[model samples]
Target: MTICQNVYFKLKKYVPDDPPEMGGLFGGRNGVITSVAFDQGVSRSMCSYTPDVNRMNAVIEKWNLKGMEFLGIFHTHFLGVRTLSEADKKYIKQILNAMPEYIVQLYFPIMVLPERDLIPYVAISQKPDVLIQKEELIIL
Candidate 1:
């Protein structure tokens, strides 16, 4: 998965040494991430993030108008959690199940800070299951 420089920079700001973690959504034309929607009203906790539906929808609407697809979610994990937790996989499975059959996969990228290490994964929607696999993140 490839992301624009601006989005990469923005993701770096999600360092959790402060308290709660941060999260957002990102997508673009083709397969490169050129647009990102940061949820200003995101419900953040010590180890969880729930997006504001209204805010997320608003951004999706704008992106749709501009012909950009909603690829997937981007979240931050506390330092040392370099991989997706079981909870994360469960939530992603739910998302894939809820999505229309036409959509085959969604990108789920995690940023682990303060190292700001980005780990990318794509969730493949396979009817009864969603398979999460590692993806190489390329910054452009």
Candidate 2:
């Protein structure tokens, strides 16, 4: 998996101090991430972030037009906590359930830290036993 440097920088710039959690969608092709859609926050606080559905849908439509595929979702977390929360797990399950059969069955739940390092979670439908696990991130 490859992350475009521009996309990474944009995600960092989207964070607002008050909410402390900012999120968006990433678009890519052939497993290489190319673009990011910084979402309009509907409900967000220090501990949580929620992307407006209309905004998410709009981003999907816009990126689809550009020939990019949905690469999964990304959000920021308070520094020092790299593990997926219960809310994260629930959200991941929901995302997995709603995923289309034709689309990729894997979802990469990424946690962006204040230090600018990415901590990624691995989740694949085929391996239910290990639904989410932390893994090193590689950005290019």
Candidate 3:
């Protein structure tokens, strides 16, 4: 998957250190990520984040106005943690289930602190053919 260079820097700026995992929704055209909708901090902890739904929905509407598609969601993982946790996986499924039938897939990137690299994945939302797998992250 491709991402804008600015998106990388923006995510970094949100989480300079560790502990409180920062995250938000990302948007773009086609399949390339070009914009981000940083969620308002509703409830964030060292290992979890609850997106501000009102803020997120508002951002989505704005992106729609700008002719961009909601691409995916991203969240940070503490240092030494390089993969999505069980809770994270569960949430991904929940998100997928919530999506409209036409929105087939969503990208999910885990930002690892200190290391500062995004490990990306794609989750397919088609029933009876559901899947979740790693995606090559291309930041440019």
Candidate 4:
């Protein structure tokens, strides 16, 4: 999947000097990411990101009205953490399983500070096992 550089820049603005992760919803059409929504600070921390489901659902509803599909989520990791932690994997599984039947979830781990780049860490629940892939994240 490809994400617009505009989206990356938007996320860059939220990078914190200290811990306390920040993230928000992303949206686009037909496999191309072009829009992202980050508002203040939803509900998150250094090691976890659990935004208000009600508010997130509302955002999805609003995006649907605009003809954009929900394109999973993006969040910043704690400083120096370039890989997803066990907690991250668990959360990814939970979110992927909770998505609507037709929706395939994707999660991007945006590294903070010294290593500022969005890492494509996709999580898909494939029946008996969950498949997580670290693939190329094209920033256009």
Candidate 5:
């Protein structure tokens, strides 16, 4: 399994939809993604609401049951703001501080303009420094 394969599988799960605005854990096998966990903020943001601490904890527990590691945090960037925003950086730092044991992965789903196309863009660092390329997608 290579990074390409991991990205393909991960992208497959969220396509053909409005795209989720959240973060979660992911498990990669031989560099291939095997599982994904969408963050709590996703649903909350959908309804223009905020998530409570307890709710966030519950979402984490749900992912824990799946036995996947915190691969990264992913959220949809509407309005073409594909770059990691200041708020995104802040949250990443907070998440890292709160869970220093795991090497968390970060992702940003860029929903292309008027068309509302969902493109899976990912970065591993606090900033959008790394862009997962299409060639990385392993045919598998």
Candidate 6:
């Protein structure tokens, strides 16, 4: 069997003193992984706060040239909600509508109880008509 390489996030910068909230948000721009860190207080329920389109576009542009694309999005799940929700699907549709050529990736950070470690589950979608492809987990 052939296996594909999974993409991971790299935080460009961050501010300290953020609360310990439940959620995750990250994005890749122009083929480079950036901004994978999230403000813990921004999560609500089983979903992380969605960034505004205009704001997101601005961030993508800051890291990429005009007409460049967003590669993917990543987020965390709290309270054991690891699967994508209806709202997440809607956001995926909106992202595809905004950048049809870009692949959108989603991540769920699973916190294994008792062990106290976080494991990430990743999914990637290339187009609206295609099914989301999940990458196998590999520990590094």
Better of 5 and 6 by TM-score: 6
Backbone clash numbers for all candidates listed: 0, 0, 0, 0, 8, 0
- lDDT per residue for candidate 1 within 1-140, as digits (tens), equals 88998888877764445547667888798878987776533554467766566776678788889999888888777755888888788878887787667778989887776677889999998779788999988999
In candidate 2, which residue pairs get closer than 3 Å at backbone N, Cα or C atoms, i.e. clash?
Answer: none
User: RMSD of each candidate?
Assistant: 2.1, 2.7, 1.9, 2.2, 5.9, 6.3
Candidate 5, 18-134: lDDT as tens digits: 434444444544434555545445354452212233555565566568664434434455455545556655555555445544444443344343344444544454432423422
> Which 10-residue window in model 6 sums to the lowest lDDT?
1-10
Against the correct fold, how does model 2 do in TM-score? 0.80
Give candidate 6 misplaced runs (Cα > 4 Å): 1-48, 66-69, 100-130, 137-140
| Candidate 3 lowest-lDDT run of ten | 38-47
What lDDT tens digits, residue by residue, belong to model 4 across residues 39-108? 3344545466655567778898999999998887776776656777786677678777777777765655
lDDT of 3 at 48: 79
Q: Compare candidates 2 and 3 on lDDT and give the better one.
A: 3
Query: Could you arrange the candidates by lDDT from highest to lowest?
Result: 3, 1, 4, 2, 5, 6
Candidate 4: residue pairs that collide = none
Off by over 4 Å in 2: 44-46, 106-109, 127-130
Q: Which residue pairs does candidate 5 place in steric collision?
A: 4-136, 4-137, 4-138, 5-138, 6-33, 23-39, 71-105, 72-105
**Rank order (by TM-score, best first):** 3, 1, 4, 2, 6, 5
TM-score: model 4 vs. ground truth = 0.84
**In candidate 3, which residue ranges exceed 4 Å CA deviation?**
128-130
Residue-level lDDT of model 2, residues 21-125, one tens digit each, is 767787888867788777645664567766566777678788889887877777777765666778777776666666666654444555546565566666666
**Candidate maximizing TM-score:** 3
* TM-score to native of every candidate shown: 0.87, 0.80, 0.88, 0.84, 0.50, 0.52
TM-score of 1: 0.87
**Which 10-residue window in model 1 sums to the lowest lDDT?**
37-46
Model 4 worst lDDT window (10 residues): 39-48
lDDT, each prediction: 0.78, 0.67, 0.79, 0.71, 0.46, 0.44
Q: By TM-score, is 1 or 2 better?
A: 1
> RMSD of candidate 2 to the true fold?
2.7
Error of 2 at 131 (Å): 2.2
Please name the candidate that would achieve the greatest lDDT relative to the true structure. 3
